[model samples]
Target chain A: MYPTDCRYTREHEWVRIEDDTCVLGITDFAQNQLGEVVFVETPEVGHVFDAGDEIGTIESVKAVAEVYTPVAGEIVEVNENLKDDPQSVNEDPHGDGWLVKIKYSSSSAFAELMDAAAYEEYTKEGK
Target chain B: MVDFAGWEMPVQYAGVIDEHRAVRSAAGLFDVSHMGQIRVAGAGAQDFVQRLTPNDVAKLAPGRIHLSAFLTPEGTYIDDLLVCKTSPEELLLVVNASNAANDFAWAAAQPHPGLAVEDVSERWALIAIQGPKAAAIVAKLTATDLGTIRNYGFATGQVAGKPAILSRTGYTGEDGFELFVEPADAGAVWDALLDAGAPMGLVPAGLGARDTLRLEAAMPLYGQEIDRETTPWEAGLDWVIKLDKGDFIGRDALVASRARPLTRKLIGYEVVGRGIARHGHKFVSGGREVGVVTSGTFSPTFEKALGMGYVETALAVPGTALEIDVRGRAIPARVVPLPFYKRPR
Candidate 1:
């Protein structure tokens, strides 16, 4: 189950707004589907990105997936702890596994995302 | 259902990784009923098997099993199978799931009479319980002393109150057993094992984990590593061939094969890049493609990508620089020795 307070992208990434900065990470469902995250490539701090841009990579025991930015912003910081412990995503995807914290240039980009209920319905149809 | 060697089978029950960890740390159950089972029974059963396989089956004592291969006239491999000498006049052969029909047709075509060959794959079910704790969990439900059965040995026992053939062999390279039971009793045995092992962290594994485990053990997959074009010598399986044994299929070719060194050899590789090298991927060396990846996967034990591929004899040395083409991108890799991970004693 995912937290209801966050917004989700169609790719299953969740973004939680905290103050002026927003935290981004994969959803619990995404981590489970990937299976045993072995390597995580975190974006560098101070990197600027827009919506739907390729940000980083996540490799599991079977395959690798590219993480994309859901909203346009500047990357203020990356989860440096993931360099030594990528399995943190498998353990806690929402908190310890957060990939990046982006300082948004405009808050309106978050409004374009789906709410928890809509994301659930969307994931059901994709399945 | 997932497409595995042209058969639609479940890749996992709960998930692949969870099932994999269960097998490594505790116990895991696998439904390998899709594998082919054949019965060869007649007065000349022993002679017939000896003529077909590369191993010295005539020396196998009753209640013992030997890993052997069916080869073509040119000494290329047809399939790697387990030959079980159930009795003096009866033998049971277990083959890969996808090669059932093909192997049956090939065996029937052999010029041997008075031999009754029957495909009994549908009548039986195969289950594998593998892990370090497999014996303890299984012993609680069976009367047989599992500790007495050595590797590659078998016994007739009652499992979940049903008669079954228990063999001390597995693909995971763990101390475990494979159970062959009647179709009606398959579900009972599965449920019983799960119940008995739940407290021990038993899980129902699937084909995905099976592939990784076998790769880590450096076991060659039939279609991938040893195919129609690959001879036993090239695949580093010369130990299975018995030159002193009497005449057999491809014996002449195998004898001659020993005289000449293999031009190409199967070697292991560990990818050192951001991409995975999958099967059919090309291995580039010296600005040209030199070999093809047979079986590749991200190893759970080593936490790295590894695979087996055919490389030229000169480049088969360990630490040789190689590149694997993954989705049109060249990823840096190096030739490493086989058995990427070994269990600690």
Candidate 2:
């Protein structure tokens, strides 16, 4: 089950808006599909990005997948803990595994993103 | 799960790191049924097998196993396999799944009078139980004396009430057994092994962990480390080739080429920097491409990046520094000795 407080992207990333700031991380399904999280390349804070921009990478023992930004914003903070213990993403993908936090202009812009029920079905289709 | 050589196999069950740790610390069971088995038996079986592989086949007495390679006529690898001499008149060849059909065809094509080569893959299934606790976990299941089966020794017996050929061999660089049983009994044996090993902390591992575990043990993979284009000398597998084995395929060329200086050499390495070097990554020396990585991964045991690569022989020394081009960025690494993680023996 996915958290209903956040909106999900087709890429399997989850984003939750609190006031003008949004916290971003990959969904549990994405982490499960990747097998094991070995390395996460953290993006530089204060970097401006548009939606769908290739921010960084997450690597398992056998694969390398690109992490894409779900919305346009300037990065505010990143989970520095990932550099030392990337397996935390597999251990706690939703809570302590949050990848980045970004300051955006409006929370209303994320209304178009898929809700939990829709994202759950999307993952079932294996898209 | 993904399609691997016509078989749908799980890349990882729980996870690669978890499975890898399971094998290292306690125990892990791997369904290696995808591997193919070919039987060679007849009056001339011993001589036929001796000519087919580079290892000293005659030295492999009954109930013994040895690693060997089926080479192209040009001294490159056709496939790497394990040769088990079940008896004086019988031998079994275990080969990679993707190369099974081709290897079977190649072996059958060779002229060896009085010998019969049969593909017995479908009739048998293999399960590898590996780690330090693997022996005890398996010892609880069968009546056979596992203690007497030295490394590479085997015996035919009943495992979980099913007929099996239990061999003391494994790919995880641990002390363990590879159980060869009938396909009809595979499901039951797998279930029984897991249930028996559960109390001892045994988990079912997958191919992802298999690759990483073998890499840490400094084992050569087929397509990556040694292929049709790479010779035994270049891959650092000259030990497996016995020149005195007498008139084997590729022996002439391999012997003649022994005096030639090696252009590139395979060496193990540790990623001292911040990146995991996966397969096919370029090995750079002085900003120029000189070699390539055969296998690379984030080691669960060492908790650092490790890989095997073929670089210029001059740069293959233990302390030589090199760069692996990871995603267009150069990450520094050093050529360490082989077997990055060894068991605490």
Candidate 3:
């Protein structure tokens, strides 16, 4: 099940607004598909990127997937604990597994993301 | 589930990591029915098989098995296979499913009067039970004394009341058995084994774990480690080739290649830096590409990224430093002795 406060993308990334910044991580569905995550490559805290830019990479035992940003923003913070405990992404993708926090350019980009209800249905349809 | 060759198979049942550990610690069952079985029989069977393989076929007496390869006249590998000697006049060849048809066609085309080579793959299914507790679990179901079936040996008997060929040979490094049964009887035998092995922590494993287990054991996969371009000398499998065993398909060519110095040699390595060095990743030293990874995985038993690759013989020494080009970033690695994990004997 998806968290109600978070917005979702078809790429299986999730974002939740936290005051002035947003916390981003992959969704639970994405973790299940990736199997056991062995490594998570996170970007630097001050890196800037446009919307849809590749943020980092999540390497599982079987395959690798790129983490993409849904909204253009400057990275504010990155979770360094993931370097030692990559399994957290598969164990708790929505909370402790958050990859980075970003200061966004506009509030309109958040609205474009699907809410919990739409995301659950969207995942059911699949690409 | 995914399609492997033409058969639909599970990549995992519980999970790859969990299943891999199960095989290492307790027990694991694998439905490997996709492997092909070819039978060679009749008057000239022994002589025909001896002339076809490099390994000493004379040593493969009744109920014995030995790993051998079908070689091209150039001394290159056609495919690696198991020669299961059922009797002096009959032998069962277990081959990779991907090369089953081609291997059959090649073997059948050879001119050998009074010899019968038939592809019995369609009628057979293979199931493997592996780990420390595999024998005890299998012992409960059958009357055939498990002790009599030595390693690399097989015996035909009833399993779960169905006729089957139980061989004490497996792809995983752990001690195990591979059961060859009629397709119709496979389901019952599989269920019986799982049910019997359940209390001992045996679970159904898949192709994903099978690969990791074999890699940890340093077993060479056909296409990845050995191919037409690779000779047995380069693959670290020259021990299987017996030139003194008399004339065979690739004997002369093997003798010629053995005399030449090896250009590349297979080596095992552990990733010193983060990131798994996957298949086809290039190994670089001082900005020059020196090798290519054949197989790699995050081993559950060791909990580190380990891989196998072929490097220039000069750089194949253990403790030599190299870098694996994973994506665009270079990850530091070091050469080590083969078989990242071995069972405590």
Candidate 4:
């Protein structure tokens, strides 16, 4: 189930505010669609990027998908465990599979994102 | 589900990596009914088949089968097919689903008296059970002696109380059987096989696993590895060409192609970088485009990104360094031997 506290993007990324920074990760639906994760390439910490920029790549056995940032921010932390155990994305997309943490420049972008209910509807329509 | 050559096929059931590993360690069942079947019968069947393909059909005795190709007069592939001889006067040609209609038309256009080439695909359904435990599962439901049928050999028998043509052949690099049954009995046969093989760790697989399995075996896909523009000599399929077996449609062209040195050769490669190289990705050396990837995947068995592609002959040797342009980033890769994985004998 999608967490209520998090905001989602149509591209299947989810972001949740945590203290001074927001954690970013792909939604459960995206991980299921991509199958088992064989590898993940995350942006290095301190890398700055704007909204909609491709911040990382997720590779499955048969295909590859790009993960885009949902807000303008500088990457503060990346889940280093994904480098060795990429299956975390498929095992627990919203938790341990979190890709990066960002310190954002604007709170306005966060409000523009969809809530959990809206994201579920968007994915249903896409089906 | 996805439309594959007009047939709605599942891309996976349990999962690609799961089913792929099952096929390598235990067993996996696949519904391959989308493949096309063509029947060639009558007095001139053998002669007509000989005239059409590059392989020597005379070597295929009754109950025998061999892989061959239907080629244009220019020696390019029309389709790669499996030729199965039920008897001297009758043969069955299994063709790719994507090229079924075209392949049937091409065969019918040839003038061969006392022979009839008919598209019999709709009347049949194919199911393949592959992996180490496949034979044991098949033995429980059929009267056909598993040991009696050699690789590429087939026999008519009853499977799950239905008429079937059981062939000891498969596209996967593992020991397996392909069951050809009537369309009405397909469901029953599939269910029976799954039921019998379940305890043995057989899982229902889909097209996703099928592709990865074949890629690991280094088998050529029609649109990817071999195509209308590619000759057999260039695809490493020269073994299928019988130049001295007598006059065939592409004999002269194949002989002529063999006379010249090949400019490019198909080779296997492993990506050394983090990303997986995909089909149509350009292979570069010193910023010069030298080749293009034809098929690539993260091999579940080898746990590495492996691919096959056509590269300049000089760079086809193993250990040669190359780079693939994945999107805009050039990823490092190295040429390896064909067939990234082989089953233990």
Candidate 5:
């Protein structure tokens, strides 16, 4: 189960607000669906990206998928620990699995994302 | 559900990685009913099988299963199958699901007099219970003494109050058993095994986990690591072929072919980078295409990537430098001896 404090995107990424910056990570559902994550290519700090831009890549045992930024922002921090321990996403997806921190264009972008209950309904609808 | 060889089957019940870990650390059950089963019975059954396979089928004792291959005239593999000698005049051949139709047709067309052949795939269902805890779990539900069942051996027994054949063999490189039961009782037996073993960490595994486990064990898959154009010697399966066996299908060709060294040999590779190599990927050595990947996957147990492919026999030695073509980018790889991982003996 995901905490209600974080906002979710339709692609299953979750954004948690911390001070003026927002931290981004994949949802538990996304990690579970991908199986064992063998490697994670996190975007470097100081990299600028627009909403829905490809920022990184995640490779599993079976295939590879691109991770996209949900909001326009510049990367302030990247998860360096993921390079040596990509299974962090499988072990603790919400905490240590945080991928990057970005300073968004506006704080109101959070309102455009789904809340926990809404995201639950969205995932159920997909079934 | 995922489509596997024309059959719709679940990749996993809980999830693939979880199921794969469960199989490695504990135990997992698989519903492999989609595999094909063919029966050969008649006065000339033994002679017919000996002529069809490259292996010496006449040497098999009752209830023993031997891994053998049906080959083409040019010594190319038709299909790799398990031939069980149930009686002097009766044999059961189990084959891969995707090759059932072609294998059946090929056998029917063979000119073996007084041999009766029948396709029994629909009449039976197969389940594989594999892992470290497999023997204990199976022993609880079956009347047979699983402790005495040696590897590659089988016995007729009762499971879940129904008649079944229990074989001490599995795709996972662990102590496990494969149960063959009546099709009508498959679902009940499956539920019974899960109910009895759930508390011990048993889960319903699927093809996704199966593929990863087999990859870790370095088992070859048909259509990928091998096909009609590949010979047993080239695929590293010469151990199953008996060249001394008098006159069999492709024997003359295999004998004549062995006089020359194999050009390409299958070898295992461990990926050293972030990329995952997949089927049809090219292998580069000294800046040229030297081989092709057949089956590759990230090993769940090792938490690293591994693959099996055919390379020039000269470069088949372990520790040879190689590169895998991943998304058009060359990723460094090295030829390693199979299997990439194995349980302590």
Candidate 6:
């Protein structure tokens, strides 16, 4: 089950809100589909991105996928550990593999996204 | 299953790492039926093959096999294949699955009046049982002497109550057998081998693992390592090209090439940096592009990242430091010796 505590995007990323800054990572479903994560290129600290901007890329042996930001914000912190240990994304994409922490300008950025329940059905129905 | 050259094939069954280790540790079975086969026969069969390939095909005895390739008039690779000699009058050429039609068209276009060229691809099914325990498992089903079949050797015998041609050849750097059976008997042969090999830790592997295993063995993939734009000498596969053999298709071009020094050469490398260098990744030295990776992967055996690529001939030596642009970042790498993994003999 997807965590009911976070919001979701159509591109398979999750936003876990913690105070004014929210943590971002790919969903469990996304990591499973991508297979083994051999490399991760994360955004640097203080780099600002708008909603739906591709901030990073995750590479497997056979494929590579871009990770887009869910909300408009400045990247306050990036996961530095994933550079050498990218398999953490495959093992625990929701927890240890959390990609970035964004400090958004306003709460309106998360308004149009799908809720946790809606996102679960979206993945289950192959959307 | 993925679409590979009009053939539906699995890239992985269990997983790449799991299937890869299975072959390295015990044994793994592969359904290589998609690989194409062309048979040539007649009194001129030997002479025809000699002219078609740069290798000295006349040196091969009956019931033996040798690695060789077909080249363009420019001395560039058309495809790499295995030459299997059934007799002096008849022989088979097993080529890459994707290159089958092109290879057939190339050979069929040649004017050899006495030699018969036929595409027998649809009639044959090829299976490879590879690893340390492969022989033990295969020996349980076949009547042929698995012990006496020297490397690059083969024999016709009954395996699992069916007629089969078993050869001592493999892409993995391990002792193994490649079984050539009819399409009708492929299922039975596969099932029987699975049942018989289960005890010896044999598992069904796929192309994903095959790519890694072959790369670790330093075997070149035709499309990437030796393409139409690259010659055998540039890819460091000059050993297979017999230049002294008279009047092959690429003879004149290769002879002229031998006099000049190579501008670029293929070398093995390992990434000491963060990212795994992939195919087409740029190799840079002092911020200038030096070469490009042909085949790269995270080697399961060594638990490190390695690959083969063409670079400036001066930078092809082992211990030369370079950078590979994987994604947008330039990751550090170093030229290393070929065959990143070698099984204990």
DockQ of each: 0.32, 0.81, 0.67, 0.83, 0.46, 0.53
Residue range B58-161, candidate 1, lDDT tens digits: 89999999999889999998899999998869999999987889898888888768889889998889999999889998898999998788889999999989
Each candidate's root-mean-square deviation in Å?
A: 3.6, 1.8, 1.5, 1.1, 3.4, 1.9
TM-score of each: 0.85, 0.95, 0.97, 0.98, 0.87, 0.95
Cα lDDT listed for each candidate: 0.87, 0.90, 0.92, 0.93, 0.87, 0.90
| Error in Å for residue B179 of model 6 | 1.4
Worst 10 residues of 3 chain B by lDDT: B52-61
lDDT string for model 4 (B165-245, tens) is 999889889999999999999999999999999999999999999999999999999999999999999999999999888
TM-scores of chain A in all candidate models: 0.94, 0.95, 0.97, 0.96, 0.95, 0.96
**What's the alpha carbon RMSD for model 3?**
1.5
Which run of 10 residues does model 1 chain A get worst, by summed lDDT?
A: A57-66
The weakest ten consecutive residues by lDDT in model 5 chain A span A57-66
The sequence of per-residue lDDT tens digits that candidate 2 reaches over residues B1-345 is: 889999999888888889999999999999999999899998989899899999998989899999998998889999999999977579999999999999999999999778889999998899999999999998888999998899899999988999999999989889899999999999999999999999999999999989989998998889999999999999989889999879898888898779799999999988878989988999998889979988999898998999898999899899988999998889999999998878887
Error of 1 at B280 (Å): 3.9
**Two-way TM-score contest, 3 vs 4, winner:** 4
Query: Which prediction has more favorable DockQ, 5 or 6?
Result: 6
Q: A25-114 in candidate 6: lDDT tens per residue?
A: 999999888777777888889999988899998877666789998789999999988977888998898899989999987778788788
* Candidate 5 lDDT (Cα, 0 to 1): 0.87
The C-alpha stretches of model 3 lying farther than 4 A from their native spots are none
Q: After superposition, how far is residue A49 of candidate 6 from its true place, in Å?
A: 2.8
Model 6 scores a C-alpha lDDT of: 0.90
Interface RMSD of each: 2.6, 0.8, 0.9, 1.0, 1.9, 1.4
| Top DockQ hit | 4
Candidate 5 off by > 4 Å: A1-24, A27-29, A46-54, A69-76, A88-96, A101-127, B199-201
